[model samples]
Target: MLKEAVKKQLHEGTVIPAHPLALTSEKKLDEAGQRALTRYYIDAGVGGIAVGVHTTQFEIRNPEFNLYEKVLKLAIEEMEKGNTPDSFIKIAGICGPVEQALAEAEFSKSIGYDLGLLSMGGLNHLTEDELIDRTEQVAAVIPVFGFYLQPAVGGRIFTFDFWKRFADIPNVQAIKIAPFDRYHSFDVVRAVCHSKRNDEIALYTGNDDNIVNDLLTTYHIRSGDEKIEKKIVGGLLGHWSVWTKKVVEMFANIKDVQGEAQIPSNLLTLGQEITDANAAFFDSSNSFKGSIAGINEVLRRQGLLQGNWCLLEKEKLSPGQAEEIDRVYRSYPHLHDDEFVKANLTKWFDERQ
Candidate 1:
């Protein structure tokens, strides 16, 4: 059964921060550290958590460790411990072959997860019709969140027609638009808006580079004589894993003035500032070599992590990436919720202990 709290949060607009893996010096999943990360998001007041997503590293699904099930369990356990009212939504990343995706979706439902974030990773090179069939198979098991992961990170760009059909699926709850290309991003919006189930499928911005602007955008969709307006209600982003208290506050600020005729001038300026921060944190300016590492660095600075360590040594931040991260830290002090992190870091760690 869908939890009332999760359903309410989705419709009311809220941030759904992506979960990042915390690794030990031995490059193993640090149970304490992972729990700390989950509690941090809860303390920061994120309405939901997306575990096992790209930010958490897809390698976790490999047979050597098979960290997928463990990661999901850890997140839910920590979420339950931290969430006073149990309002936090849990979205497990469900991908791989059709059977694997179906299995994960069933497992997620068994664990009380509200939704499954479906990626087209294993279905690559398949015809669109075949892809749609795979999606429907998983949707039968649980409500699925369609993903538009950027091609920069091994994501396929589904045709607009494909998206239109995908949205029409009854159990597809939302779409995370992260194409990063303005044109392709709109294709998702257009597809959903034109779908008969438009009202049923919500839109979330996974475009880390244009988060603020995406939230501020307004799309008017015309199907027949009826005109329906669409807006990116919130986000499910890896960028949100760090400085999350501030991210939640930023979402609140945007929600306050959504659809207003007189938008605060500062809100416009924030878009550029956030993009600059994302460029550095995402390492987009440097071929994204520091993608996951960049996020871990921020947490390290906040004392939420031991260091910028990953399971794979090759995933370490690129040359000069540290300097770029340091530059953004100094330049965009407003963006980091350092104060909040400092105050809660010790407590978060203490909880795990």
Candidate 2:
């Protein structure tokens, strides 16, 4: 069961970065680097950390790597050691079919994860009912954070019906709406607004492309004679993994202006700037083939990662991807947390000793 404090935190909204993998030059898990990255996120003031997710490389689940359990355990261990608040959420990325996802959910629950950020990436073979059935099975084990991952990154497009039915699942505490399409994004909002569990489900934007605006705008959905209102409270994004200190600050500013009639123009400009940076970090130019690598590259640059190596040998920065990352580094220095990571690097590493 989800803790009352943690559930309250999810509803209140907070930044939760899709945690990335840290690797050594030899293409092995860099345990020190991984711990340090966890430390980095906590110290950066993020509300939560999601491990074993897309940005952490789904390849970790392969038998050859067998890092799914290891990564999840390591992150939660670090989170506990960090003296995180009662509301600091620990999310485990749950994937695969029913049996596999169930096992993972059970293991995550055993290890103290508050929610499962369930991914439906490779389940395209299942019909919509089958998909919902799978979700119900997983939720029976642990509280779920439903993910509407964008298709560009191995995720299928879930329809409004799917989302509406998903919201009905009793244990679904939140949904990360990351279709990356405005219409699809709206579909989730409208579906939830119309659901019986609308108030119970907190909407978080996994739409890295529209983070700022997603948080600022309130959706007015006409449900029967009443106009129901909803908002994307926070983000669960890979784009946030890099520059997280700034992301936390930006989220705070966005929250401060939530009900204001006139948003400051600078927030709008910041949104575009963030999107521009995400394009470079997420490799939008290359169909996001290098999205994971791009995230690692930024961390490597900031000294949070030892090197930008993914478990899959073929996974590396795309052509001109590094140059684009450099461009964003130059273009938006304010978005980075280089100095924060630098100041605490040694201390974080020493704590692990």
Q: Cα RMSD to native, each candidate?
A: 1.4, 0.9
- lDDT tens string, model 2, 1-353? 78888988899899999999988888788988899899999999999999989999999999998999999988998999899999999999999999999999999999999999999999889998999999999999999999999999889887889889999999999999998999999999999999999999999999989989999999999988989989888899999999989999999999899878999999999999999999998899989989999999999888888888999878889999999998989999998888888888898787544
Report model 1's TM-score to 2 decimal places: 0.96
lDDT of 1: 0.86
Looking at candidate 2, the ten consecutive residues that score lowest on lDDT are: 344-353
Q: Model 1 off-target regions past 4 Å?
A: 84-86, 351-353
Candidate 2 backbone collisions, by pair: none
Instruction: Highest TM-score: give the candidate number.
Output: 2
Cα TM-score per model: 0.96, 0.98
Report clash pairs, candidate 1: none
lDDT of 1 at 3: 65
For all candidates in order, the CA lDDT equals: 0.86, 0.92
- Rate residue 220 of model 2 by lDDT: 94
The alpha-carbon lDDT assigned to residue 28 of candidate 1 equals: 85
RMSD of 2: 0.9
